[model samples]
Target: MTATCTWRIWGLEASLTVTDPHRLGEARSIVDTIVADVDRACSRSRPDAELYGRSIRRGRPTRISPALCTLVDAALDAARASDGAVDPTVGRALVSLGRNRHLATESGRPEQAAHADGTLHVGPADHTVIRRHGDMLVVPEGITLDLDATAKAVAADLAADVIADEIGCGVMVDLGGDIAARGETPVGGWQVTIDDGPDEPRTQIALQGDCAVATSSTLHPRWRHRGRSMHHIIDPATGLPAEERWRTVTVVAGRCVDANTVSTACIVKGAAGADWVAATGLPARLVAADRSIIGCNGWPAPDRLAA
Candidate 1:
């Protein structure tokens, strides 16, 4: 008995698949609760969000809720894994580049692309100084935190875990494009359609065992800033959106958080991304701006996924 449920949450589409059809309702409630909790704790655009308020009043140590703590830790891990390519300390950088608010509603607006005035200052990973001990987190007086890269994926992982344990059945959770699954898998596993971009052809993959998949793209969440096209994937070093190289990158990893980390970092890494993704030994698909594609670490060949 298998069933699926899809809903809108936190400005993204969320879907839950359960092996036991009778447990679908229970699974939906679990995922909804998890997403709401995560949004309240860590949403970058929510003024009332815990992360937003804390970013405003930094300097002293603040005790965070378990959910926020988990997200912060995940962000830190992503930064460390990618050697700061996926820094969470870029919150101020994002705001300076006109990303302080939600992009889903304001995308493609020049007003949403305010010119950055000052130099974007973020030092090496060690000197950046975001310290965490248990649930306590401390940052520089003016440093803002943005965990958008990993937060949603972590939320999906949490939801999948809870649904599988509580219902004692196989479960899959997809928040936006970050996906995680556990327990039993369908005969061919979960079939996932990968969206390369508007101009590129989409492809499909199957997730077997306990694994996760995530994709980061410059094609979406885009806008015009100062008469130039911009996107949401900011490079911390420049405090600006990454330049066009690969339109999108998708990765498969043991956890959704990890997969998202690699995908986002690859976008920031630019031309060196291919080598970086290869080093990680994960299957990945990278689509160039011209719609040309690159496969790494054993991803399906272009002929196999061509539009």
Candidate 2:
């Protein structure tokens, strides 16, 4: 029998599942520890997080924890891989877009993302010195690192890997929509539903082996700033919310972080997203604002998916 648990974290849903019922609690513990570690180090919202406050001040040249450093590295890697379609320096841009304060009283929830001018000190991380490819990290002056695009997916990967290895069972970790799996595949594999919203078309698919899927959207976790809609995914080239060409994009990859990176980049790539992710050879599903589906790299035809 399988066991599962669900809770809320950082204002998003977090779920864990294991093939062995008895190991469920242990799996949760492993994920909890991983989440806490990441939250402590990478949360841009936390005043005391390693990437916040004085730790990121100009000319600080701080040496961050390996975990946070690695997350930043992954964000930078995604930026390069996506040709700046995904970037970490949008933290300052988000602040400029009115993310410096909590959401307006009507929302009653903490602010998540906003539009930006994309005025980032963009450069190679080469100046920061990554010795031996280690997690050592340094943020350049005039640049504020934002790991919102990668940290959660990386944490899900880490938690799933650890839980499966230590518990000796198949495991799945879903941090919001960034999902990961490891160890054996259960009967019928891990069935996932791609349901972007009430108005969006939906489908179900099964993942096999050690793999992951991520869904990056223009709707979920969105907000209104100055009476205009805004989303979390930032297109660094424009320093603005990605145009809603595809209302949501889902990608399947060997690792959750990689899948999320590509999916988010697709959102930023807009009209060219399908071609870009298709070139990567990973399967993906992109739903347009009009609810039409665009499949790439062997995603089943729209007629084959659940309604």
Candidate 3:
């Protein structure tokens, strides 16, 4: 029989499902340790985090831990893959839009809808200040490094790998909406429910084999600043929240990091996102502000496959 556990850490909810009931406790411990380690290393809210420490260096590369280096590389890869739409260099932009701090500290609901009323401000994308050379990294002075977009997803992938390899069993880890599974999956695969609004019927999808899924939405974490609407997902081209027709996008990929990267970038891509998603050949489901749905790539037909 399989066992499942859920806990809160780093201001996100994490769920773990393990194949061996006997190893549940051990698996949870390992996950907890990994989560905390990743938070310390990646979270920009933590002034003591490695990402923050090295991001302040202006001209010189600072040596980082192998694990941190990997995370940084993954983030950069996401930026490159999405043509800067899912930019890691948007830390300054995020902070200016009031997403620089830990969300839990100033929270209403955990995932509040992100919207704004002011004119969309267009600005140039931030220059790439983050550079990695071997195990060292560098960022210009005064540039903040916010890994909010990819760190949790990467952590989920890492935790799932750790649980399956060390515990010698299958496992699934969900950090917020970013999910990853390895080893054996439950019968019919791992079912994932997608919900992205204050009140909306949920949709379910299944993941078979070694797979991951992630959702990015503009309806969550929304707030108005100085009478202007703002959200966390920043368009690198314009340095503003993407005024996309779709409010939410869900994607399935071989890794949680990749899924998250695409989902987020799609939001920034706006009207072109559906075609871009199709071009990438990743199955995706996109929901518009009015709740109309569009399926792209290989997203399952609604109601054809029961979750």
lDDT (C-alpha, whole model) for all candidates: 0.80, 0.77, 0.78
After superposition, which runs of candidate 3 have C-alpha atoms over 4 Å from their true positions? 54-59, 101-123, 126-128
Q: Report the poorest 10 consecutive residues by lDDT, candidate 1.
A: 103-112
lDDT (10s digit) by residue, model 3, range 144-219: 5567889889989998988888888888898888999999988877877887654864688878878899999887
Tens digit per residue, CA lDDT, model 2, 233-257? 7767655677889888999999998
Number of the predicted model whose TM-score against the real structure is largest: 1
Pick by lDDT: 1 or 3, better one? 1
Which model scores highest in lDDT? 1
RMSD of each: 5.0, 5.8, 5.9
Window of ten residues with lowest summed lDDT in model 2? 102-111
- Give residue 137's lDDT in candidate 1 (0 to 100): 79
Cα lDDT over the full model 1: 0.80
The alpha-carbon root-mean-square deviation between model 3 and the true structure, to one decimal in Å, is 5.9
Model 2 clash count equals: 1
Clashing pairs in 1: none
| Order by lDDT, highest first | 1, 3, 2
